[model samples]
Target: MRLAGNLLLAVLVLAALAIAATYWRAGQREAAARAAYPPLGQILDVGGVQVHAHVTGAGPDIVLIHGAGGSLRDFTFDLAARLSDRYRVIAFDRPGHGHTDAADTAGRRFDAPRQQAALLQAAARQLDIARPLVVGHSFGGSVALAWALEQPGDTAGVVLLAGATMPWPGTLNASYRINSSLLGGALVVPAITAWVPLPYARQVLAGIFAPQPMPESYPAEFGLPMALRRGLLRANARQVNGLRPHVVEMSGDYPGLEIPVELLHGDADEIVPLHVHSGPLSALLPDAVLTVLPGVGHMPHHAMPDHVTAAVDRVAERAGLR
Candidate 1:
């Protein structure tokens, strides 16, 4: 009896040590992440959440929303700076990404793109971004669609860069499924934030931008540490995992869309398939234009910034804003 009791005590002690270590490492990582990648934009108090908006240049307004696991830095690195010369470029760190806090503290209800769009719209109003041309990449594209749908009068045009629109086959990626769950988010997420290696993260990023080279300095310049922080990781996982069903519901509303849309997708994109998303979406919308990049992959904004800028210019022309 004493032997069994001692063995149980040892297990309990080890478990307690593991939990304590996880929390300690998580705290250290969070601090390091903040120090390494401090906010580059002004934080706006938009109702329940604080949004990070980076504004530059002075011309017609163009709001840029980045993909999952990305921040405003993704655009500011090159694209936003380039576009700024011709347009007033505003790049936003989406709710629960980068410096922005999640719209829902519970981290469940606000995973839908519509919820994110609403929060961004509110922030845009405060910033006086009127009838702006919105550009969204990957997951942000879905939010761009929702924004146009919810606030047509406020949106002049949309540019979707390999946007996830239609409901695709397959379950949520394994990492997202695990990290987004209650038990995993509470326990496993902190461990990942504490221990994931930079090389592995780079490898994953390379795959996403496969068939095209990622900019040499993108990982560091885009603030990788900020993306690996515990809270944002959980938020991204939840949003990505819960996205499919939301896309299904949102897809049905595409036919009624009136605003001009310009979609630029790569034929070789393995991340969000070109055939599944933009192809069908272009057909559904009345005023939609699709451009297929012959040899490009997912990150068109990086791989073909000229094409992306041209698309934005086309949308602006169509909207009579140019």
Candidate 2:
């Protein structure tokens, strides 16, 4: 009995040491990420939260909101620069994902699309962005909808690039289901950030851009290492894991939004299935125009920038902002 107890204690001590080492490694990796890739834009103070805003070009304003698990660098990669000559483009790091601070509210409210919109909207006000056409991709699409829904008068229009609008029928993937849980968040996430190699990001990116070939410059330019940080991993997991309820609530208020919305979704997108999201969303919005890309995947913006910009142009014309 005494020998058995000693063996159990030894195993426990080894396990605890391993866990501590994992956390320490996580902190070191996060620090390295921050040090290597500093914020590429100004970090604005928006009502107590720090917002990272990258502004370029000069014309009617256009706000670019990136999807889940990414920073504003996603836009800075190419689209923002492509549109810069035609419009004053402003790409933002959403709360808790990039450099933007999460909402201080309880219940992890930062995951709520409304909360994210409100925070980014305040930052827009600070920049004096006048009636800008808002563009959101993937998860960011929900934020764009929330922006238009919350403050229609302040928005010129909206463009959703494969937006996750309507609530889906089933549960999210196991990673989101697990990581979003309270126990997984507290225990599993730190281990992930610490031990997971940054190169593994490519495997995940592969799923996001299945039918379409991922651009060679995408991974490093998107700041994948920074996203692998513990805080970001937790924030993204929680946001996506708990997203369905927020979308359901937002869908109820969709009828009240009067702004023109341009939607561009790829038919082949498995990430946020087109039939499940944009297909049903088009029926709800009174002035929504959806352009289905025949063979493109989840990232319509990256796969088809011309079509995406054309939609933005249409919205600008319709909104009388051009």
Q: Per-residue lDDT of 1-322 in model 1, one digit per residue for the tens?
A: 9999999999999999998899899899889889998889899987657889999999999999999998999899999988888899999999789988886554444578999899888889898998999999999999999999898887999999999988998776798989988999888998888888989888887887788877889899888878888889888998998999989999999998898999999999988999999999999999999999988998999999999999999999999998
The list of candidate 1 runs beyond 4 A from truth reads 104-109
Candidate 2 lDDT, tens digit per residue, 1-322? 9999999999999999998998899889889889888999999987667899999999999999999998899899889988899899999999887788766534344778998998888899899998899999989999999999888998999999999888998677799877877888767998988988766877787668879889887888887788888778778988988889999999998877888999899999988989999999998888989899999999887899999889999999999987
Candidate 2: TM-score? 0.96
Least accurate 10 contiguous residues by lDDT in model 2? 101-110
**Model 2: per-residue Cα lDDT at residue 272:** 93
Model 1 residue 128 lDDT score: 90
